[model samples]
Target: MKTLLKNGLMLDEQSKKLVKRDILIDGEIIAKIASEIEDEEAMQIEVAEKLITPGFIDLHVHLREPGFEQKETIETGTYAAARGGFTTVACMPNTRPPIDSVPIVEEILEKAEEAGYARVLPIGAITVRQLGQELTDMEALKKAGVVAVSDDGVGVQSSKMMKEAMRKAYALGLPVVAHCEDNSLAKGGCVHDGEFAKRYGLQGIPSEAESIHVARDILLAEDIGVHYHVCHISSEQSVRLVREAKARGQKVTAEVTPHHLLLCDEDIPEPNPMFKMNPPLRSKKDREALIQGLKDGTIDVIATDHAPHTLLEKQQGMERAPFGIVGLETAFPLLYTNLVRTGELTLAELIEKMTRKPAELFGLPYGVLAEGKVADMTVIDLESERPIDPSAFKSKGRNTPFAGTYVYGWPVMTFYKGVKTWDQADIFVTFEE
Candidate 1:
C-alpha cells in the first residue's frame, strides 16, 4: 500500500522557510514530494498546518543492553527515541560486556531488528572492553557493522595508545568519536569547578579536564587526517579549539547536548544527581559559549548523550551517584521550547543540527525527505503545549530534571521506512508493506 501525507509544511533548510508540500511514500522509499501529489491507490492523511521534517538522528545514545538491562534495553530506548521523533540513533558502546567484538556488535544489530523501531547503528569500542590499554581490531569491528569507534564513558588515557587507535581507525575509514577527558585534571570532581561548586563546598571538575583531551585529540586527528568527533562538548575552551581546528580545515567535528545548552551550574537547585553528568555542566559563560558555538557552526551536531541510570543509582546523591541523565524523551521539546522559541536558534538551524548535519557527518543515507530517499520522517505539533511527565516516558530511566516544564512542538507521528513506528494523536494510517 502507498501512503500520502497531505497539507504539511516541509522545512527548506537552505532558504530557512517552510514550504507547503505533499509527500507520497511508496513502500520503503519516498516516491514523490510536490505541492499536490495525487495517487489514487494511496492512503491519504491530512497533516494540516503540521511541520514534516526528516526524522531526527541522535549520534550519541546508550541503549544499555547485553549487560545493563535494568537501566535500559534497546527496545525501550528506541521506543523513547521514536517518541522524541528520532528514526535513527547511534548507540554508544558502554554496555555490560561492551560492544568490542564482532559478536557483541552483531548482537546489537540483531536485537534492534527484532525490536522493530528506530535504526540502531552500533558504535564499536575503540579498545577491547573499553579498557583503553589495548586497541580493538578496527577492521573487524567495521566489517561487523559499526558506525564508528569510541570509548565514550572515559577518554583514551594513553596518548601513544590513542594515536595508534586513531591511525587504525583512519585506515578503516571510521571516525574516532572521543569522550575528551584528562582524568588527572578531572580528579574525581562531580560538578563544574565554578561558583556553584565553591558556594556549595563541592569538589569541582575543572574545564581543562575536557579541553586537554580535546586539544590532544585534535592534534592527533590533524596529524592523521582522520574524521575526529568530540562527544558531548561542554567546555568553552573545547569549543574554541574545535572552531580553530575547523578554521584550519582539519577533519574535526563536535556535538553539544541540549542540557548543556539550556542549563548551567547555577541551575542546580540542590545537591541532586539529576544535574550530575560527566564533563559536568559548567558556568553561565560556558553555556553561552556553547550556544554561540552552535550558532557559529563550531558545533556540528546535537547528540543526546542519552545515558540512562537506574533510579537507585541516581538517588545516591550528587557525589555518590553515577553521572548521567535520560535525554531521548525530552531533548527535542526542551531545545525547541528554550532555544528556538526564545529566538536563540531558528527552527531550521536546530533541525539541521539534529538531522542533516549528523547524517552528513556520519555519511548515513538519512536526514533528507527527497525522492528516492528512505521514508523516515516525523510530523510535529508545533502549536500544542504540554508538560513533560517522566512517568509517561517509555524509557526505564525516569531520570530527568525537565519534569513539569511546559513545552511546544510535540512529535505526534513518526514514520521509519514508511512504517508507522510511533503515533501519539492516532494519526498514523498503516499501509501494508
Candidate 2:
C-alpha cells in the first residue's frame, strides 16, 4: 500500500528554509515529492507544521553486544536509534570479543537483522581484538560486510602498526576511523587539564594527550592516502590540526560530539561521573573553537559517540567511573535548542550535518528525500518543548547529563524503508480528508 504524508514541511537545502511539500512513499522507496498531490487510494497522514527530513545517520555508536549485554544490546541500541530519528547507525567494535574477524562481524549483522529497527552497520576492529598489536584482515573484513575499520575505545599506539593498517585499508578503499589518544599522556586523567580539574585537585588529561595522536594520524593518513576520520574531537589544538589539514587539501575528516560542542570542563558543577567522558570536556575556548569549526566547515559532521554504561557503573566516583554517556536520544534536541534556535547554527545547517553530511562522508545512500530515493525519513515536532527524561529512552542505559534540560525539535516518528519503525503515540495527527 502507498502512504501519503500531507501538510508537511521539508528543509529546502538550496533556499535554507522550510517549504511546504507532500510526499508519497511506496514500499521502501519514495515515489514522489511535490507541492501538492491527489491520490484516492493512498493512506494519508496529516503532519501540519511538522518537519519531514532524511533520517539521521550516526557514525560512531556502541551497541555493546556479543560481550557487554548489560550495557546495551543491538535490539535496545537500535531501538534507541529509531526513537532518536536515526535510520542507520555504524556501531563501534569494542565488545568482549571485538569485531576483528568475519565471524564476529557476521554475528553482529545477524543480530541487527533480527532486531529490525534501525540499520546497524558494524565497524570492524582495526587491530585484532583491539590490542594495538596485530593488524586484522582489512580486505577480508570489508568483504564480510563491515563499512569501516576502527579500534574506537582505544587508539592504536604504534605508528608503524597504524601506518600499515591505513595502507591496507586504503588499498581496499575503506575509511580508517581513529580514536586519537596517547595513553602515555592521557593515563590517570579523568577530566580536561584546566581550571575545573585544578579547582578540584584532580588528575587532568592535557590537550596534547589527544592532539599529539591526531597530528600523528593526520600525517600517516596523508602518506597512506586513506580516508582518515577523527572521532570525538575535544581540544582546540586538534581542531586546528584538522582545519590546517583541510586547508592543505588533505583527504581527512573529523567529527565533534554534542557533549564536546555544548559543554566544557567548567560546566561540571562537581566531580560527578555523569559528566565524565573520554577525552574529557575541554576549556570554554575549545568549545568556542568547535562551534566555529563547524560553521567554517573545518568539522565535516556531528557524530554522537553514544557509549552506554549501566547505572551502577556510572554511579561510581568520577575517578573510577568509566568514560562515556548515552547520547543518541539527546543529541538532536540539545543541538537544536542550544545551537540552531539560538542562531548559532541555522536549522538547515544542523539538519544537513546530521542527515546528509555524514551519509555523504560514509557513502551511504539514505540521507536524501526525493523521487526514487529510499523512504528513510523522520518526522520532527518543532513545537514540542519538554525536558529530556532518561526513563523514556528506549536504550537500557540511562547515563546522560542532559536530564532535566528542556529542549525543542524532538523526533516524533521515523520510517526506515517505508516501514514505520517508531511513532510517538501521544502526538497522533493523522486525519482523513
Candidate 3:
C-alpha cells in the first residue's frame, strides 16, 4: 500500500522553510519526500495546512501490564501513545512481575508485538525485582532486546549495588537510567518540602533527597565510564549538579517531565492526589531553573514520565495515594501549546528533543523522516483547540490533573511503521498488505 501526504508544512530540522511538500510512504518506509509528487494511484491525504514531523518518541512511560492491568495494559497504553502522536515508548520495569530477567523482557516484547499499536521497548530492571539489592543478568537481558535498565519507581539505595549495576551496564554498552531519590530522606513525604507542605501540614520530600542521589550517580558514572541518564528531574539543585557534571565532561543526560515544566507547588490548590507524584512538584524557582536548563541544553529531553493509576487509588488523600499521572496523551499538546506556541521553544528545537535527541541517545532507528527510514510519523492540527477530556483517553487510568484545561495543537493522525494506528475522526482504519 502506498500513501501520499500532500501539500503539508514539513518540519524537518534540515529544511530552512516549513516546506510545502509531499511525503510518499511505501510499506513501512518513507519512499519519497519532495516538492511535488503526482501519484494518482496512491491514497491521497491532504494535510496542506497541518504540520508533518517525525513520530514522537518518549524515553519514559509506565504501561502497567504483566502486573497492574487495571491501571493500563500494553495495548491500551500504546493506543494512548498513538493518540498523542508518539510512535515509540520505552516502558519502565516496575510491574507486578517486574521485567528483571530475560524471560520477562521477552514476554513484554512478545506482547507488544502482538498488540500491534506503538512500538514498546521494555526497560529491564537494574536490580532483581527492582529490590535494589542484587543486579539482574544484564547480558541475558540485553540479548533478549531490553533497550535499557532502570529501577524506576525508587532509587537504588546502596551505592555499592548501583556501582555494580553500572559496571555491568557499561560492559554491555547499555545505559543505566537512574531514578534519583534518597529513600531515607523521602520517607513519609508526599509532596515537596516547601511552603505548600508547611501550609497544609503534610510531610514533605526535600530536594536533596533527589539531588543527593544524582550527585552520587554522576560521580559513579565518571568513575566507571558508563552512560547514565536521569529520569524526571524536578529540583533546582539537581539541575545545577547535572550542569556541572556535563561541564566536567561526564557521560550524563537528563529528562524533565511536562508537569515539572508547567506546574509548581503553588499551582496545586489543595492536597489533590492527582498532583501527587514522585519527586513531587517543586518551587517556582526550581521550575524556572528546569525551563532554563531545557533551553540551554542542560536537560537533554522532555519525557512524559507517563505513570497511570486507578481512580479509586487517586481518590484517596494525597499522602495515601500512589504517585503518577497520565502523560502520553497530554505531552505533545501541552508542550506545543505551552512551550512552542508561547515562544519558550522553537518548533524545530521541540521536535529535536522529542525525536532526534532520544533516538541518538538510545541508539534507536526511528524518530526521523527520510528515504529508507521507518514510516513512523504524526500529523498534527496546530490550530485545533480542545479541552483535555480524560474520558477520551485510551488508557484505563484517568488520574490527570489537567482534566478540563483547554489546549491548542492536538494530534489528529498517528502512524506506526506506515500503518495508521489512530485517527480521531476515523478510529477503525486498518492498513492492508
User: Candidate 1 deviates by what RMSD?
Assistant: 3.1
RMSD of each: 3.1, 2.8, 2.9
| Deviation (Å) of 246 in candidate 2 | 1.0
- After TM-score superposition, what is the CA distance of residue 363 in candidate 1 from its true location, in Å? 0.6
Cα lDDT listed for each candidate: 0.92, 0.91, 0.91
lDDT of 1 by residue, 1-433 (tens): 7999999999875787999999999999999999988899999989999999999999999999989999999999999999899999999999989999999999999999998889999999999889988889889989999989999998999999999999999988999999999988886799999988898888999999999999999998899999999999999999999999999999899999999999999999989898999879998999999999999999999999998889999998888999888998788889999999999999999999999999999999999889999999999989888888877788899888888889999898899999988887432221111
Using lDDT, rank the candidates from best to worst: 1, 2, 3
User: What count of clashes does model 3 give?
Assistant: 0
Model 1, residue pairs in steric clash: none
Candidate 2 per-residue lDDT, tens place, 220-266, comes to: 99887999999999888999999999889998998999999999998
**Deviation of model 2 at 266, angstroms:** 0.7
- Tell me the tens digit of each residue's lDDT in model 3 across 255-357: 9999999999999998899999998999999999999999999999989999989999999899899999999988988988999999999888888899889
